[model samples]
Target: MRGGPPQAEQPDDGEGQAVLGTGPSSLYAHIVNKDDIDGLLIGRLCAQIVLPEPDPDAWQDQIRDVCAQLRDQYLKYPGVFRAALAMMPTNLDTLRVNEGLLAILLSGGIAPRTAAWAIDTLSLYVGAYALERSLLVQRQRREGDDWVLSRDDLVGRFEALPSDRFPQIRQHAGELTAGSGHDRFDFALGLIIGNLAHA
Candidate 1:
């Protein structure tokens, strides 16, 4: 699947947005199983599978029927347990290396368990992604202010962090939050897609 630049975005992707109008990253949120194909496609590459390629009308009808049923459940009982696959976050570095990797994995006929395991391994990205988004939102809000990040500002006044108990935190303070937002994400994604080899 590793080929070229990432393709088109899903038109309806903006719907799965968080309550705070925050965007969900490429991270999967457990709604990709049999009953929720449409849900999986929200921010993930699964959306580009092109289900309607054959009989566009039929494809649209089927997709709509599925989405409608899902939407109905939400209206009838908000926050109900809807079925989904809940894939683990896979190595994204490979994806950035080759956008087509997503399509390959989707069609590869790999065991679902293995797929899930791989996804789980990439789960580390979720936290970094969330933090980056929060930072961006705050930065946008305080855009005009001359925000100088000094060491004092960096090390927020701690009230007994128990460094003796958690030595790693005390030792690698900067490494914990070293890179720029983009750099951090890129680094995490590098691990995600890092193991790809041309077939």
Candidate 2:
């Protein structure tokens, strides 16, 4: 689950295979290609995300719980989202998660088309968030700096913007970055769920 482009480690054949503790031939024999490996990893991660039983009264809340669990799993496997982002998860584990989400939306009276599309949007939204966060943490570690200080500096820069040119940025800099990742995630999740219900 290396971040960014999936490149061969040393520009040599079987380097990645070695990393997986297998010979080049054996690795290729089992896994068809990099995409296969991505599927396997995605399946494993999907397994960790538990989906609650469908509940008409609490469907929205149950969906939110699943999202939070997924976020936690992705964080635990830093960079996994980047690697598996493009993979189509047809595996049972991944499908089960999708099924659970769809069931919840259906139970909440969301239209079929909207619920289907919402699955993709919600999945991508959470995956992208996890990927960005993991990459930022990795970069901070490599640079040996405090993320808190960096975030503060960024906020300060925003506040220092010329009020005449960037009034909104200058005025709401604190509110712009006030919440934790979970808070922001929850806000967006609630919005999506609310829209589904209203639609």
Scored by lDDT, the top model is: 2
lDDT of 2 by residue, 36-137 (tens): 666656677788887888899998899889988888887877766665568777878889899999999898888899999988888998899898788777
Candidate 1 local lDDT, 147-179, one digit each (tens): 635444555422125777867666666666566
TM-score of 2: 0.83
Determine which window of 10 residues in candidate 2 has minimal summed lDDT: 10-19
C-alpha RMSD (angstroms) for model 2: 4.8
Most accurate candidate by TM-score: 2
Give the root-mean-square deviation of each candidate in angstroms.
Answer: 16.0, 4.8
Per-model CA lDDT versus the true structure: 0.37, 0.76
